[model samples]
Target: MDRIAFDIAHLLAGGLVLVSFMMIYQDRLYALLNVFALHAVLLSLSVSWQAYTQHAPHLYVTAAIALIFKAIVIPGVLHRIIRQMGIHREVEKVVGVGVTMLAGMGLVAMSIVLMLGLTEAADAFAREDLAFALSVVLLGLLMMVTRRNAVSQVVGFMSLENGLILAATGAKGMPLVVEISVAFSVLIAFIVIGVFLFRIRERFDTVDDVALEDYRGEVE
Candidate 1:
């Protein structure tokens, strides 16, 4: 049963990483946000499964945070902000999709090869978790680099934090790092989103980051 549970957690974590890859490949702002929301939900499930495997009930709290904040509230707020600002369309990409995807594939391969070498025999779950976390981290970076908009960059950053949380939880004993991180990320995510949304609105009258950068104060 323990082995089976561990395998399930590994599968879920892997699924989350795959979703992050999809997010990297996204073009539209709404699609990116929606993919991210799904990514959060999958992370929650993966964490909850990890909790079940490790017999740590506190992780349920982490899962709850992921669901409430990432899956529901964050996306909800972003959707409303986009609607209000009338900017619900594709964010500009700095690089072409094909090139970005090729880069993303490099990241995913590096994650698996590097992490598996580092934690070769740690355990069934730990090795898998590390690989997935690394993948998520890389995917987030890819998303950040490929997107020209600040809002999309923020989304990528938040998703990177999600990967960090996954790594912390997968370690032995449900460490202090995971618990503190969950709380810290929740606080940071909400605060940053609120501030950015306003700044985005104030400058461009839209949540589009490309426009805001263009509006940055210039010599008269």
Candidate 2:
């Protein structure tokens, strides 16, 4: 039973990393949002599995927050915002898909090597989960840096937070308060970024970060 539980948890954590890769490759805003929603769904499942295997019930609240907010509400809101802004069909890419994917693979390899070296004494489950979490976080950063749209950057940031949540749940005896704080922080970030998106649109008539950079006299 222990081995089975570990395998399931490992698989779910790996799924999150896979979804993060998918997010990096998406050039279209709508497709990216959809993939992020899928990412959040995978995270919720991963957290719920952790809760079950560790017998940590408070993790369920964390899972529920991921499902309701990240999976559903955030995506729905972002979709509507894109539609209203008339940017649903737009595609933005600062780097080629091939290059981004290769870089992501390198980051994953590095994460695995680093985690394995640093966590030699940790449990196998935690070592794998932390490695995957780091991969997801790095991929999210790559996604943010390679995208020109504000919405896509927001998606990247949220995906990065998903990785943090995954790592937290993987650790044994993480407090409920810490999980709740993380969730609230993400919610606040979403709200702030949503408003910021609107403001950018209002001023520049678009949500392209490169354009905003130019407007601010910043090198792009």
Best by TM-score: 2
Q: Residue 78: error of model 1 in Å?
A: 0.6
Candidate 1 residue runs with Cα over 4 Å from true position: 119-121, 190-198, 201-220
Global lDDT for candidate 1? 0.78
Candidate 2 per-residue lDDT over residues 101-198, each given as its tens digit: 99999999999999988746887778888999999989989887877666777788889988988888887877763556466657746664665565
Candidate 1 lDDT over residue span 1-220, tens digit each:
3667777887888888888878877878889889989999998998888777778888888888889978898888777777777663777777788888889889989988987787446875688788899899888887877676656777888788889888988986856855676676667667556755565642223435565565675423
Q: Which ten residues in a row have the lowest lDDT in candidate 2?
A: 198-207
- The superposed Cα distance between candidate 2 and the true structure at residue 207, in angstroms, equals 14
The best candidate by lDDT is 2
Residue 92 of model 1: what lDDT? 76
